[model samples]
Target: MARIKPQALLQQSKKKKGPTRISVTTIILCNLVVVLIVFFLFSTYRHWSQRSRFQTDNQFSASEDGNAFMDAKKADVPGYAVLNTSKGFVTVELFKESSPEVVDEFIDLCQKGHFKGVLFNRVIKHYVIQAGTAQGLGATEDWTLRGKHYNQLDMSLNLKHEAFMLGTSKGKRNDKGFELFITTAPIPNLNEQLIVFGQVVKGEEVVQEIEEVDTDENYRPKSSIGIINVSLRQKI
Candidate 1:
């Protein structure tokens, strides 16, 4: 056998070094790839986390407002009434001092859940709904028995039924509880007759929709505008 030369051994050593250099380069590239993947995953997770936090904050704000309104009602302080109707929610600030009798009657009825499922009987388009008539042609007929006592109250207080009047009167001297009406047009005839107590603060579109409903021969709504619930809310 021929003996190997020193230069030939050196050449073999150079060939082995080539593969070792390639292996080291491959290891470095793999480490760089792993670092990039980790960075991308971390960035995506952070984005998702921030978005979730934002949604949670918005929901919390809405819930807080609702809770505050409920708290105000429980206190019996001068608060607004939130009327949930089929069309939309309407908010009206009750004038307790200006119309004490009417406000007291409305609060009492609300506490007893009398206005629930009631209907907006008479709706004149662009005018108002002449409700609390106990016509028995609309949604609920629970309050129909109270029709006789609708206008049975005395008129010595000089309560006038103007625009947005929350009075219970048949014509002029019959102001009592369990009756309310909102006006769109100028009805000066009710200036010194009905008791103006509250004005609508929200959901005027719901009022507009009520006014646009089909009416009967007596100008009453063909179908009743149902009052889902009437709860007191605080003005925030």
Candidate 2:
């Protein structure tokens, strides 16, 4: 019987050890790659969640009723407007106590027939029903009363964007004051910049009806919605 050489036995051991070492290294590398991928995915998800939360905080969010500031007893006594729309009439109670100047301007405009023929050109479902543009989209006749860009009045009180709340936007364009909108749902995010001068006291059903109207990409109602007339009345 021939005896195996010590060197041959050593060589056989080296060969087996080589494959085992390679297998171990490969497994380690694969595990490292998996860890990196998981970390990357976690980082991406965290970034997206933070961005989404910030947008939610800044953009439209439903809030409580606009009447929270009004005293129950005096709620019935606030001066109100009767907005006769193509759909129907919607009565709005103005917040004269908190926003005196803004309310005065709005009332004065109504009395002067500034909004009589104006149409609610822009309408968004569950958002707002915008109108008061002099010639609808772009005729350059906005801010008819001042004939200039409307000033941003201070928001006198903390008011919620409840359904039927009347609001106005502030910006550099001449149409700032001319464009008015009614909230179909609470928009807490708009509480800071937009003005809330009134709340619908009657015919809120009419406002909801307007929200149901079909609109274009620009939120302009496909079918016209004109303000047949608007009138102001002192609280009795």
Candidate 3:
């Protein structure tokens, strides 16, 4: 029992003890904060990555003719359609940039044998040849990939209806259906009045041959010329 002053006792009482042990609550709270932070960062990164990846896609430049086109440097998603007809096989280049959903629907239909044995119901000499029923009357039963004209893009990109152009038949303004057509000559009257989604890159002579086929007053080919089959593939 050494004599100690009250001030000394107070100082000793104020001395540091052993290190404080972290409680379970503190540990859990710290871990939860770390997890939340990681989750936020991860979500942000995924969003940025997706946006960056598709930013260049579906972009286009306006041409002098008011036609929309993806720059030459930018890669094009062109589809090559090899139409096997009674006359002959014709190759076409469908531009996805002009009409994305329409082109996709067309490709889907072709893959599912949509046009197999389908007649070119309407054929006009030196003008155009047409197929697919109005409003796609008999094209149902898994044939409709989407709603009727749900992806309506009329005269998309102001695509000109030039010679050998492929387009959808219109019943009314912006009311086009599966009825497709190919021009044997430049149908300037139909320019901006129809959606020009594709062009015959090769076998123009074949299309011309079909145009010259025998047709009645209603422009229906008398000899029953139509598509035997249609094959599609990727192009540059």
Backbone clashes for every candidate come to 6, 1, 0
Model 3 lDDT at residue 27: 98
Ranked by TM-score, top first: 2, 3, 1
RMSD of candidates 1 onward, in order: 17.1, 21.3, 17.2
User: What is the alpha-carbon lDDT of model 2 when measured against the actual structure?
Assistant: 0.70
> Per-residue alpha-carbon lDDT of model 2 for 1-236, expressed as tens digits?
99999999999988773433457889999999999999999999999999999887655432223344445534534398888999999998889788776777776677678888788876656556778653332343332321121112223434455567887765442423566778776555667546778888899889989988876555567899989888777662
Q: Which ranges of candidate 1 are over 4 A from the true structure?
A: 1-75, 135-166, 170-177
Ranking of all candidate structures by their lDDT, best first: 2, 3, 1
lDDT, residue 111, candidate 1? 78
- Per-residue lDDT of model 3, residues 5-50, tens digit only: 9999989988959789999999999999999999999999999998
Candidate 1 clash total? 6
Candidate 1 Cα lDDT to native: 0.66
Candidates' C-alpha lDDT: 0.66, 0.70, 0.68
What does candidate 1's lDDT look like per residue over 28-146, in tens digits?
99999999999999999999999999999999999999999987765665568888888888888888767766677677778788878877776655345755655322333322322
Identify the candidate with maximal lDDT.
Answer: 2
